[model samples]
Target: MRRTAISTTVLALTFLAVPATAQAQTQYTGTNAPIKVTLTVQGPDGLLFKGKVRTKGHDVTPATGGTHTCDGTNAGANPSPVPTPTAALDDAARVNGFTWDGTWYASFDDYLVESVKGVKSDATAYWNISVNGTSIPVGGCQFKLNAKDTVAFTWTTL
Candidate 1:
């Protein structure tokens, strides 16, 4: 009878301990943290620029929405922001010597697309930004990033 009592007590304690262990596992440990986002620049001809930049981990929260700030600019479309792609290029500038003249943003080492010309003028290719194959409403500065998000810049002709 005593042995049975001891076994019963151990079983009950084991059951109780299982819940605690499970709860600890569920708590966020920041694993798989977003270290960088993939940046792909493409043109009508073919792939132009391909690179990766470390994510700043700044304002990664989705709740911040349109409130995130970048280089003294706010989110939303007064002029339509391409924040994610722009931000990636900015990061690239610091890390990879990338340069931009208006819509043209690329690393000089590769000089893949040469210069992206014009904005609203006819017969000019413009740079378009997208994340995971979907265009974002905001620009790079305001665009929040998750771990390993893909940011793409495509040059399209008018």
Candidate 2:
């Protein structure tokens, strides 16, 4: 009779511990956590496009470090590189039906922003990138993303 009681107690404890362990293991990591990126396209007049893009399903990770750093991830299952700023623009375009055009430079995969919402970069002003008001040292294609990042592409001489 004592053996039966001990067995039942042990089973109950095992059942209780399983859920706790599972929850801890399955908790959200950078891979599964929801990420939000705010994007803005500016022209000489002021703002052209601004919005937030969020994804919770895809695995997103921050870049290690440096001027060439930008958030990157695979597309679904493909191993191809996708930069955070580029992804943000793509997300905004998909969400709002906004059209954006860019030109890729050499073999670096760097993108030069040409136009957004019909505003073209002219001779006097060129499109430039900034994050949270600070100019990005790297090109858009190389910029890595962190969660809730603010990415801006402005057309100005400055």
lDDT for each candidate structure:
0.44, 0.53
Off by over 4 Å in 2: 1-34, 55-83
Candidate 1: deviation at residue 23, Å?
35
Q: Which residue window of length 10 is worst by lDDT in model 1?
A: 103-112
Model 1 has an lDDT value of 0.44
lDDT of 2 at 6: 45
Candidate 2 C-alpha lDDT tens digits along 13-43: 3223444443243222244344788888887
Candidate 1 lDDT over 32-87, as tens digits, reads 23357788767577775677787452322111123233321232222232224455
List all candidate RMSDs to the true structure: 22.2, 21.5
Whole-model alpha-carbon lDDT for candidate 2:
0.53
Candidate 2 TM-score, C-alpha based: 0.60
